[model samples]
Target: MVNEISNPAAVVDEETFSVRRTIRIAASVDKVWRAVAEPEHVSRWFGLVALDGAGVGATGTMTFPDYGVIPLRVEAFDEPNLISYRWGNDDAADARPDVLDPEKSTVFTFTLEPVDGGTQLTVVESGFERTSAPLENLESHRTGWNEELDKLVALVEGEA
Candidate 1:
């Protein structure tokens, strides 16, 4: 049988620094990547609390209503294959700090590959160091990825 989903978080020093989720869709890898890398398509499922949208090298801010706004920047792009970006430090506390960890801000990547039965989509987000960033930082992202991946899977399979 083919695998439909896989989310193996890469752990470092007992804490998950990054959360990676992958889903095997019935559609082509290109189709899956488009839904992930495009702005309007990502807005359907990813908008934080409010949607600012996404595009290659485009920087935007997402409003979170009660959570304030988080700025995001696209750092890499390879059509239908890879996309990386920098976002606010996931470890930032609800209360703002005088200084944010620049290194821990983040760089997320989405890698798409065609598997034997379907498309294998892998998302790897790494930037947090074991000691500097709070463990909660990585945990928050772990939860967010779970929700986002579900939305992505639904969006792609549901569409014609």
Candidate 2:
């Protein structure tokens, strides 16, 4: 039987200019890591992810059906434990270039931990203060994480 973990929605902190969410999934750390770090599995739960390669500094694009493609780069990674991505969040940049704006991009880090029943995943997206619209973007991303992570939990757990 699968463990019923209560995953909460993402939270937006205006003072820190970030959004955070924690979820417990009934799956192994390796499995959960792939779901979040691998391009193929990431696309299944998040947006359509297309990455140049693995490891830090690898560039990529996540395309949402209505939102267009957002340029992203793997900022950091540590095996099946943690990974972070820096992505463009500038709404004014309608062109959606292939490069990330150092001034307008946000960094989102995913931390995974092994738990009693499965794995605990925490995602913190920061640097919203640098975005064109901090409040607007923060709220939007807060909602986005909640929706996205829920799908991630479902996908990983279902595969177990």
Output the number of the TM-score-best candidate.
2
> Compared with the true structure, what per-residue lDDT tens digits does model 2 show for residues 7-89?
88899889999999998999999999999999999999899999999999999898989888889999999999999999885
**Candidate 1 regions off by >4 Å?**
1-16, 48-56, 91-101, 130-133
lDDT (tens digit, per residue) of candidate 1 on 1-160: 3235554443333244566666676668887887777766666777652224545657765545445666677778887788887667554444232223455476778888888756778787776663245566666777777777777777787773
* Candidate lDDT (C-alpha), each: 0.65, 0.89
Query: Candidate 2 at residue 45, lDDT?
Result: 89
Residue pairs whose backbone atoms clash in candidate 1:
none
TM-scores for every predicted model = 0.73, 0.95
**Model 1's TM-score against the true structure:** 0.73
